[model samples]
Target: MATSTGRVTGTARDRAAGADGARGRGRPKKAGPVRRSMSQHWYAWAMVAPVVVVTAALIGWPLVRGVYLSLTDATEATMGRTIGVNVIPSTYGFTGLDNYVDILTSGLFWDKLIWTVVWTVACVGLHYGLGLGLALLLNRKMRLRSVYRLMLILPWAIPSFVAAFIWRYLYNSDYGVINAMLKAAGLGAVGWLDDPTTAKLAVIAVNVWVGVPFMMVAMLGGLQSIPGELYEAAEVDGATPWQRFRHITVPGLRIVSSTVVLLGTIWTFNMFPLIFLITGGGPGSSTEILVTYAYREAFTGIRNYSGSAAWGVIILLLLVVMALVYRRALRKQGEVW
Candidate 1:
């Protein structure tokens, strides 16, 4: 019986091997060319490729060209050609650091830089203070809350150029509403845009007014996301309103506050159209920010392309440094997660 069982097992194993060989012979040996049609995400790539190419052409080319043009004597008027000789000497050749040094050493540039810093700090500080205060007040359930929110956001919703233009008119010396109000109050009409100090202050005020709406909206969003239970816990701990705000609200909003501050700084630093359209960097260039200075260098003052490029490079470096600093500081505070 054992011999019979062994014979049967061997026969079954041989049959299995034979079946495997037969199956292998019946199937094709090679996988025919994959035959992958242009279907799965291939069409999406095809659609986006043109856009990617065009964007690269528009943005990348100009950035690369700007860097190259910075090194050469490229100007809008002249396409960077040597005036007399092909072999240019140091006097006529590429200035390695002169452009940068010129802007750096210029008293006007430093004065503008200092004013720019002061303007940015003041605007950002006021914007956050007023905006967050309003956000907190409006975050509570109140009558006409929606109306107030809409009214608050209207400043931001309006185009910045339009707002700037309106403010410019409002600050006009002769017929401005501001001057009229001052006269009505028995005070002398203030030349808001004529005097250097007044002009700078006026621009900063307009900036703060227009900028606070955005900060308010951002803070309102952040406030809504804070869990009410935290506030309840604070109340249970017998915390005062200020203490609750300091502990729960402020801590919850640290990340948002940092973001708003950084964005406000960048926007305030890059403020151009407002100052240009309103003051035109007049009143002795007191309100000229880096962007306005760069524009003047590029377009007005001898059309110094090298000077403009140097200014652009410096602004880029400053922004990069600020971004790095914010990242480092926020990360240390564990606010960047």
Candidate 2:
């Protein structure tokens, strides 16, 4: 009888403690759905208010304005004009989807888009491949590894525009370093920037030089993050170098590689400085990618403001679609970020 009474009292005390804990946590759940009033979640809304306002001002406003401009007939010459103290009304009229229709109907869009895709793929591929190789080498103990890393990363440390300008001089047809070196080796001086094919390759080389450092750094971080014990354990199991890498290193670096590859693709797709500065979309516009072509439309000769806006919107949509597709693919592979 005494044992039964003690057990009942202990159960009652446990229930009381749970009630106190729930009260300490602010509120308890109801049997059905519970509605939270503004007073209950005011702190959270307050914390989010700044970010919402900033987004609406910067990204939201520009995107909305660009979309609106793409829908209308805006041009640099006819859109709007202003005096010192007067605000001029915008003359651009809405034309629905005419701009998009024109762009889609034209062959130029598809052509430049194809070139852009090729450029993106080539540059990102070289970047990741060379970067991973160098990262793997540098991760091992070696003499002067730090010096080698510093030298390799120097190109990325320099400003991209400066590097582009330097490469342009190096590619000069007469008395350039590259041509001089070719002559020294008894090889005929080939025009690096004059020919369309060579110009495309030249730009890719410059971009790869500038891009690989970032990829190497990211991959190196991923390499270091994989525990040393994992490799040691693999060695103990008599796993070969290739087998251990396939099983452990690749899986461990997946997150880093995924992020860097995505970022590299996006950056390379929109890379303007190297192409614009080096090629100027020359040799009959043979090397012009989508971004450079849009640039030509916006700033060169008679500015097509609405058309350029349409191009911008198109590029934005394409990137969004690519990102969504990439994310879906990653999700399918069980990689969530």
Candidate 3:
């Protein structure tokens, strides 16, 4: 009986080995050269062709034209003007890097850039700090959470221009509620917009107010995604509140915080309307950011078409560099958005 069992097992093993040898010997046939059929590929391209056309016509053309103009000494008048049915042909000459050189050598650009950097940093810092604090408080199991959320989010819900106008009125040195309160408290009225320093702080505060709600909502969502078990376990292990927050909560929110910080930086950097509506880059251009300054170059006075284009291109390059550096830093820390 033992010899019979061994023979049967040997037969089964032989059969499996034979099957594997057969498969190994029969290699798959090599693929022939692929032939392209117009009919097959045309359909795929047709599906995406409209999007390509629209994008090229809208975005691509404008970008190309802006770059082209930036190299030339173009202005509204030189770009061709039609006066009383007689058309003046475009005769703007290309001047290579002259516009860029002139802009770089100027004192005005450096001053505006410094202020712009300060504005972006101050607003985004306050936005994230205040927003994360609020989000943490709201994440607790507290009553009237919805009510508090609505009240806090109202600033973001309102149109930005409208909010800017309202804040502008409130910051008015005369006939404003803020000043009225100051007077009631026996304090002198402050020129919030009239002074350079106060105007900077005032705009920064308005931007923070408008931006905090977005960061709070994003963080609150992140908080809810973290499992409760981790916090419970930490508490059981004798973890303090601060330890739990620093160890668990912060790591959980890092991805969300990084994303919001990048977005907030970009938005605050190019926030033209808020500054324009509030102080109009006033106090002799003390609060002028790059975007507002570029606007003045384009639309005000003689309408410096090429110079504005140069500034616009420079701003775009700066933003691209900032985004790349930020993403690389986050990637180093094992974070990506």
State every prediction's TM-score relative to the real structure: 0.81, 0.84, 0.85
Model 2 residue 211 CA deviation in Å: 0.3
Model 1: C-alpha RMSD to truth?
8.0
Candidate 1 runs further than 4 Å off: 1-54, 80-93
- Estimate every model's Cα lDDT from 0 to 1: 0.86, 0.91, 0.92
lDDT of 2 by residue, 10-79 (tens): 9999999999998879875454322354467778888999999998999999888889888988887776
| Model 1, span 118-210: residue lDDT tens | 988999999999999999999999999999999999988888899889999999999999999999999999999999989988998888889
Residues 154-232 of candidate 3: C-alpha lDDT, one tens digit per residue = 9999999999999999999989889999999999999999999999999998999999999999989999999999999
* Model 3 regions lying over 4 Å from their true place: 1-53
Candidate 1 vs 2: which has more lDDT: 2
Model 2 lDDT at residue 328: 95
2 or 3, greater by lDDT: 3
Ranking of all candidate structures by their lDDT, best first: 3, 2, 1
The stretch of ten residues in a row with the least summed lDDT in candidate 2 is 29-38
State model 2's lDDT.
0.91
The prediction achieving the highest TM-score against the true structure is 3
What CA root-mean-square deviation does each model show from the true structure?
A: 8.0, 8.6, 9.9
